[model samples]
Target chain A: MTLFPRAVNETTSRELRKTFRSPSEIFYPLIFFVLVLTMFPFSIPPVPGLFNSIASGILWTAALLAISLSLETLFKADYSSGALEVIHLSGANLVLVAIGKSLGHWIISGLPIALLAFPIGWALDLNFLTLWVLVITLMLGSATMSLTGSSISALTVGLRGGGFLLVMLSLPFFVPLLIFGSSAATNASLGIVPEAELYFLGGMFVLSLTVAPWATAHAIKIRLG
Target chain B: MSKPILEVTNISLSRAQKLVVRDLSFSVSGGEILRLSGSNGSGKTTILRALAGLILPDNGKVARLEEKLGNITTSSNSVIYIAHRHGLEENLSPLENLNFLSQVCTPPPIRDGVSVLETLGLKTSMHVPTARLSAGQKQRISLARLLMFDAPLWLLDEPFTALDTSSKKQLESMIDAHLDRKGAVVLATHQRFNCKSHVLKHSLPMIP
Candidate 1:
């Protein structure tokens, strides 16, 4: 068999197993996403119109924060345990490893957040079409965030206080995704087609999908050096 | 004599802007072992990492030679490196960890994880999480990779640390057998290797 699929498959499976075994990795960011989304209604004045209009913004912001939270430990565990070194020296394709990790991260964190956003968006007074739009936008946006965040996490893998550095480095890149994502939901809520914003989020997703893994692999090599 | 499996020519490696190994050179051939001995902070691990291609030498060449159709070609895939850390996942059992490794390692594992773990005397605890295993047991699991992969050149750092006498002896024999199979090893350690093979010692000087 060719090396590409096998390497990516094993790495991704290993990542999934590790994350599942440690329940906290799967639950913490999810709980944090719930908490952040729940806080919006209580903190703001109780106006149905205000909450409805801004629900998408609140959801997207919470997702961005939750993804960053999950990414803090992305490469730290592998680097500290020396698994990263073994993977690198084992002649496995580092780019494929990066891609596998991003896929695993999205499955555990991004996918859950996207699904949870649906019910949460409904509770926030979002219409059915708007709620659908929110979930779809989050699915696209959080994946893009995970991809971009993986590179940032890999870059700061071994640094002291890397979590803060990760958030700072990734926030600027996440802004465009957040904007496009929330805009799509808001437009849907307002009865507009929302096609333009959805297309922008899709474009960003494709861009990050192509570039992030390579950048993450390079970052890993640099961090190791 | 067989062609050298690995060659290092005038390599200098530095860490954090400080030169750790300066103008060092060495080579290892089949059925041979290169032992790197040095005090702490003397750059033995750095040199091993450089040989493993994990770290690029600031100034020289480290090459792995493969005989292809009677011609030698430089190939980096023939080496396996074990670092100071055991690289075990705390949550995974030894069997699970090794099973994952067997699939990911290049050329794949010649021997399965269960037999290797059994040989390491971890038959009873193979299913226990690695965090529950003692340091010596974890070290044995790390060294299990030596048996798992068929790479010709092994770069091991402190492979003896945390091992009990019997386990240490077990590792020595494993190394000896690998050499007997025409494989090469470059090891960094403090304990004297109790194997019958002739070990060429390269002592690294402590850099000021």
Candidate 2:
């Protein structure tokens, strides 16, 4: 909290912008989400009551998984191009750098994802609380996913076929987020209070915000060294 | 006219599990150009990486100028590290490469990509994807770093590789200008620099 350290996230934000703008990167996850949901509707026979009952859980699960996959790009590109070293050498604080980039990730991947997911909910006929809860849960939950996933991504950068490796490394950390994300929506579906799940999710999000950046920032330094 | 700019009391390096360099000691005053020559796997790149503070040395300390020397201690502007990889994104053009490099590095005298390429004899291919450029051209793009960075120390590993005679001459002159400005260097190259004045040579054995 010292004023000596200027909080400019310029380098981190610029790198994040580059990843989000890559031609090969954009649109795949959103398309994948739509395609995956399309499968559930086809596999199960058309029963509107059945679909409505399970809609919140199903939609939130899809959102969580899709955003997890997208967070893999956070540090891999920076590592490969030697830009990560440059960032460290820039003498900016490692924690602020990590936070700035993670916030940008939530903006690009998580927010648009929530916006897209709501319309998909209307298609699946989700109720009002389920809609807002899903959006809120996903926004908070995906930030945790992205921050912790950055540590996993940095560790596996040079490994062959690292995408699968990253998921395997990070899935254990993400289990709580997934459980709360689905149950919050599912509990809301039953017209019951989901405040416990929401509060737990909120606590996990704060813990991630507090510690995940330092872990990830040091992880990059160790990987580079 | 006082203390030397660099002090390496005794430095040793180990990569992975094996000791590649050990118990070595040397120092350079300002404006000195020191060349390191040896066969492949002689640990030239490892030493260069260590000097740039990329890889930590196992046992020694490296101190730059003292506080009285007006050195910006935390800033990396005092030294620049260059190697074959160019450390550039291939998908981006040379112009974009300059922009990205400038964004990450600290404040310095920035140069246009076209002029950098021109000085390295890469004028016609400045806008091409670096992957499309030849090996020599890519090396030139990497060395274009010299144009933008005004560091006092250049830790160059194999800086002369894949360069034509004229390109090599250009680099030699560039290093000359660097030394004339009181900048020092630790250059590792297989090819001959052939500069007689103000050059120090250190040869290492290629460990079996």
Best lDDT among the predictions, by candidate number: 1
Q: List the residue pairs that clash in candidate 1.
A: none
Using DockQ, give the best candidate's number.
Answer: 1
Give the alpha-carbon lDDT of every model. Answer: 0.85, 0.72
lDDT of 2 by residue, B129-183 (tens): 6668777777777787787767777888888888888888888898888887877
DockQ of each: 0.54, 0.32
Per-residue error for A186 in candidate 2, Å, reads 1.8
Q: What is the C-alpha RMSD of each candidate to the true structure, in Å?
A: 3.1, 4.2
lDDT by residue (tens digit), candidate 1, B126-183: 9998889999999999888787777899988999999999998888888889999998
Where in model 1 is the C-alpha error above 4 Å? A1-4, A41-48, B67-77
Q: Looking at model 1 chain A, which ten-residue stretch has the lowest summed lDDT? A: A1-10
Candidate 2: give the clashing pairs.
none
What docking tier does model 1 reach? Answer: medium
At residue B79, give the lDDT of candidate 1: 76
